[model samples]
Target: MVATRAQLIWIPSSGVGHLVSAVEIAKLLVERDDRLSITLLVLNPPRASKSNPFAELLASVSSSTASAAKSQIRFQELPYEDDPSGLGAKSNMSLAERHKPQVRAAVAELTRALDSPPLAGFIIDMFCTPMIDVANEFGVPSYMFFTCSAAFLGFMFHVLALQDDEGKDLSEFKDSDAKLDIPTLVNPLPAKVFPTVVLDEEHRVWFLGAARRFRETKGIVINSFEKLEPNALKSLLGDDKIPPVYPVGPILNLEVTGRSDKSSEILSWLDAQPSSSVVFLCFGSVGSFHDDQVNQIAHGLEKSGHRFLLSLRRPPPTGMLRAYPEEYENLAKVLPEGFLERTSERGKVIGWAPQVEVLAHPSVGGFVTHCGWNSTLESLWFGVPIAAWPLYAEQQFNAFMMVVEHGMAVEVKMDYRNDLGMETKEIVDSEVIEKAVQKLMKADGHDEKKEKVRQMSERSREALAEGDSSHLAIGRFIGDVFKNIP
Candidate 1:
């Protein structure tokens, strides 16, 4: 058992992707050193729905008594009342900004309830940087944890610096077709694929405020590794650009539970398939498509004649299209007419899949993904290449980085947007879907792609091992926090 203890409290932003990253990194830190303990303060609103990931994460941790005890980590809910100051649905910046005051108050209340010696430090997610003030109030050091790739951070920093040096943002390039001049980028970002933050003026202001706040923190901990983003990491660390940078990453989907059971329908079907034969298409949990888009996907899969599994969610009530939940209750109803019947032999559709487990399976060959960092890292961890389809946020940039910059993915559409904001204005036709899937799973010269990804998978595993780069970064992070702890 660990003799001396140092507990650090981590507050993650309110979303599945952000919450999962914090939990994964928290587990990695504890595993790397038993003497370290973590208290995860999940921010759940009083009127939150069951769909919230915080409850699910806490349940998973509570179910694992042995692991929880061994790691000496605790979970707490930092419940708050909602404020209606920000706009709805699309922008994360609004939500993050609205939660600032409430989070500060909740954390102050929580500080009084703690019985142990004062916390070693605060590890706050980027979305919750307002909590850094609480750490300062108690004379404790605080660090920022970025949930996305280091490359995205590098680009955002460059953009922010540009705005200060010159009053122009990326929006100026929308008409001129200019490329951003960042140090680490070999090729410049096109005007259309610019991060949504710069496209919306309010978002740009929120992002600039967030970036300014990040500079105030003691240091930053990015969920990336040296090998994954060498130049981006180098540029960020050089010039003392954005506080002290610690690259501790390749933090994967370390679910407290094992893979889904063999008896589950999808897993059972996958077990019978030959090795590396099926393509798995899963977007993020909140991701789904329009009915027109869904139909096109079905047509494409049938044309390709490849075995596939696709995860789709029914559209929301107020969106552009109508959802047929009452009459045609099944997913087939949402697809193109007669499409499912035709592809029944080769395709399986589910509302949700055990994504991490499914990716780890031997029979899985490729992924049609939204290019979220979690999904990208998980795909690389399992040696599965991607058919990159980025819908929103920093995903377009991620697609660019993976397919163009890194050469690990085939492009479905990096700039695929149907509507300007949240809705799709046009459908990805059957021809585009068919071509992308074929290239990912069945193209002739695909062995090199497979071999490249498989090697990346091995490197990811090695990066987190005892003596690798990520492992050493974690060691340094721990030492920096507690080496002078009184």
Candidate 2:
């Protein structure tokens, strides 16, 4: 008798960040269990072009997997169809909901194929929860792959319970001085740090609906290690109504591939800097600033008198939605006049940084980040303390957690939201930026936040080792998957 291979279907949201995380988790799953295989149902949103980062990354992964002699991982591109509902292209939630029919068709075909292995379960992205109905049709269990922090997950559940069970209107809390008593955070969560979507009526409804659907899943696989978020994970596991929680992560794809000459140049520049002297300022792919804000940052860096590398980007053209920042044609146009000349010996401004490479460098002492969970984890992994400057999404919450809950970061501005079309009234002036950067890059090398980050860095690696927290969580998750397979 031969061992039966179980197949799992992964449906990640259409964003490049989400896809990268899902791919990393899928790779981890297959490498751990030879009897398991994964097929990713790739989604392409409207107006996605070859230049899109998601497409480029998918092509790269496919090419690498194709070269392997016996690869268990495969990619299945879903047929593209414009969302009949005009709202689908507006947000990730609407876009995922529009793919329900396509997902159903793909699962039906996969189940019908004679050569396909036994279907195990559906692992859907946090935004793609609408596909849970299709999993039910096939009599398979569905699990959610949350790409954010465990504390944020707890916040979502709390929001759902507050709205449904307690009939509390969350919008009233906006702009108020009230502090929320969420179980995940040791301190009360301030109203200002609430995600912007929660305040908007339309987006809030959609987000809460997704949170409600999360309860239908068998479990949630969070991309965070246990030691990094013990209090939040403990609160989640203690809740009986919530499904089983899996904390198996720091699932980073550290391989440096398809490096451009610009990346090499950036690395070489870091090599010449003094040890623990450079402060790196690189936001996420979509993070950018207006000319005025850029000027403020420039003055701040100049006044700090610190060695710096700034990854500045131009915002997308007018009327373009869901677009990444573009490279500026000339740095002189947006930068402060003669600013580059003044800081010539101490600073370098560039676009499209190789973030992991820069963080891994020995000379980088601190990070001024957008507080995206992936960037936060990378900073922790490299033992570099962060100046938390959140831009959008759940980043504000992540910043709050790091600065207030974990005491591992210096707060630049936790509640900043760069919403498109809105005036950025709360500009972080040069003075605040200068003070934050100085505090973050203090030369004492004995800052408590830095020490805490260094300690978490070691524990993050330990969690993934044999018999540790993350490793055991992975084992338990795989065991549960096998148990559910008929």
Candidate 3:
């Protein structure tokens, strides 16, 4: 029953979040159409070097699919320049400038890498528009995947249109005070609501390239349920000139089945606590904290008087994260003196936990997050309230939406970033965190808000359902965009 159709190649950028979402999309595409064979184009470094997660995951998925007799999904590992992991090398520049050139290179290289088996179309990460141009070069249609809200996408596009082609400066952005046309953004937004990259000249130009490249594509695919970003979605695609848009979202449900081993341990700890007594803290994959900010956060969490599970990635050289000072890294020492001991039976600190599984758990009630789009959708999907601590970019905008517009979360308004390093200022103290946690845990007047989330979740599900808006959009894309293009 293997019907041969045009091949679709998915080019997902590196990072845990992007990689996971890309896999989910690929899996869904294959599930919907057995005739659609997919080849995930993963970029890996040399053979001797540590295998990048992108390549490793692709290999694992390929092996698992084959063993399960679902051998239609395939993987191709593209070599990187110099080292297998240019992660460190890529980090040398600000995120705004790092990937444009690499994307351009990957385009030419990827085409050559797949010389014999012609690619039918491409589904590329929003940031990797250079590949879209490559698709155009070969007379193939390309689709853009915005792994965040249409609100974020609109903001990026507006900023790009405002900037000059050279992108050497952003004088126009600094003084402007107007809300961009993002759907459902009830709060009046200022120009500063966009990411820092949009405000800087260099970053502005780099992002412009990606957006421009996107416009050249056949359509856009978003990793959001239509209900979650209604206003933003309408603003971007409601216009006839914007090309097609498909909202196939909250894709976590597709691949997620149960808790992982680490998540189970965290859930067990949460189970012992009273209902809604815990605050689940997880910044996205790469959020870093200064020692001073970390100390203050520790102080605030301790003061909150709630059961807590705080997950940290590679900790820093000193303070709570330092491994050599293992004894001091214990909750009591790392936090205020009496704080951890008082809540000892209630709190736990783990490196990483199963985020979605933990979020869906009944014991968990609130989230302290970095405001990444995926995390935003997950929190809303699970009906968890939030304490937002935005570190960078549109995170500030997301915090505004959660606290001001949606009334789903409270923003922790402490200015931690400045040229002089993070000021030792603590805006909302532990008592404040504790109070917010209490209100969120309680039924209070939040039932209406909960209903809003529930309704949105339903809409999200509907969008991805067969013959629904997103499904129809994808179907239209296959018939209209990809079918006759070649």
Candidate 4:
């Protein structure tokens, strides 16, 4: 008599960042436990096309994973139809809501298939909480794969409490001086740095609803390690109402593939520079700047007098909801005149960056980032200090945690928000950028901070080692799935 393997279905958000993290965890689960087989139900963007990068990414992942043993990890593209009423373009949540029927059908077919593995559970992205209903219909447990910091998770719970438990209106805090005493952080959270979702009425309602649904899941699997976020993880674990929390990460996909030509150029340039001398600036996939802001940054790099590698992307056209950053055809139009020539000795500017490889380079000492959670973990994993420049979503909160709560980063502009129109409420001037870069790259000014990050990097690795915090947490999660198997 052979034992049956437990089957899990993963529904990740359409964004590359979220999908990549989900895929990494799915791979981790299958590799750690042979009794588990996972299927990722890939979601296509509303207006997906042949040239769509999301489709290409899914193809690349599927192709790469085709060689895995026994095909334990699989990718299934969920059928998507454009919303005729144009509601899908409104927000990611709305688009996910429209996919519930497809999800239900997919889950039902998987469960009913002959010789199918026993259904263990459904693992969903944070935005796909509506699919919890589909899980409930099948009488199987569901879990959320939170792609952000544990601190951000705690913050969302706090936001929900303020709205429901205390009947407090969250709108009043926008741009105000009010401070929130969230249990996740050591310091009080200033209202100004709140994630844009909490401030916007529609997004706030959607997020609060998601937070409420989070309690219905069996547990949450966060992509952050224990030592780096002890306070938040402890706070979450101690809470009785929230689902059981598992901190099994710093789960980064460190493999750098694709873009060989551009990556080779970037690496060759870094090879010639002095060790610990370059400041690498890269915002996340959708992060781009206005022409004026790009000019300021170029000037800033020139004045900072440090070697640099800048990944500059063109902003999406206005009113395009699902647009991505495009590489500039000619850099001279956006950058200052003679700027590239003047700094040619010490700087190299490119479009798309191989971020993980760049950070792993010895010549890279500091990072100027958009402070996305994935980027944050990557920087810490490589022991690179950060200059936080948050653009949108929950990034502002992430930046605050790095610079204010943890002392791992210097502030470039914590409150910067670039929305659909590529319009910014505030522009970080060249002087501010110069000073932040200087502070981040100075030899003696932040030795303590630098050492702290280096030590944290070691702890991050240790947490994932056998018998350590993250490893044990993954074991616990797998055990729970087995226990729940009927």
Q: Find the candidate with the highest lDDT and give its number.
A: 4
The digit string of per-residue lDDT tens for model 3 on 1-486 reads 222465677777654567677777777776766656666666533232222234545565566555543755766655554432223212222221333455446545645864323456878876566666556666678887778776777766665555545453455655467555444365666664555555555445555667666677778888775666677788887666465777777776333444468767877787787776678888765454544455666776666666788875543233221111111234344455575566578788776557887787788877888787788888877777777776554576777777667666766652222111222244545555566555555556446655565666667667777877767665665665335436
**In angstroms, how far off is 275's CA in candidate 2?**
1.1
Q: Which residue pairs in candidate 1 collide? A: 418-424, 418-425, 419-424, 419-425
Q: Compared with the true structure, what per-residue lDDT tens digits does model 1 show for residues 263-303?
A: 27888878888887899998775566767788888888888
**Order of all candidates by TM-score, from best down to worst?**
4, 2, 1, 3
> Against the hidden reference, what TM-scores do the models get?
0.89, 0.96, 0.80, 0.96
Model 2 misses residue 445 by how many Å?
Answer: 1.6
Single out the weakest 10-residue window by summed lDDT for candidate 1: 319-328
Relative to the true structure, how large is the alpha-carbon lDDT of every model?
Answer: 0.73, 0.85, 0.61, 0.86
Per-model clash counts, in order, read 4, 0, 5, 0
Give candidate 4's TM-score.
0.96
As a whole number from 0 to 100, the lDDT of residue 477 in candidate 4 is 96
Candidate 4 structure quality by residue, lDDT tens digits, 295-411: 899999999999999999887666554467788899988999999899999999999899999999999999999999999999999999999999887889999999999998999
Model 3: how large is the Cα RMSD against the reference?
Answer: 5.4
Ranking by lDDT: 4, 2, 1, 3
Clashes of 4: 0
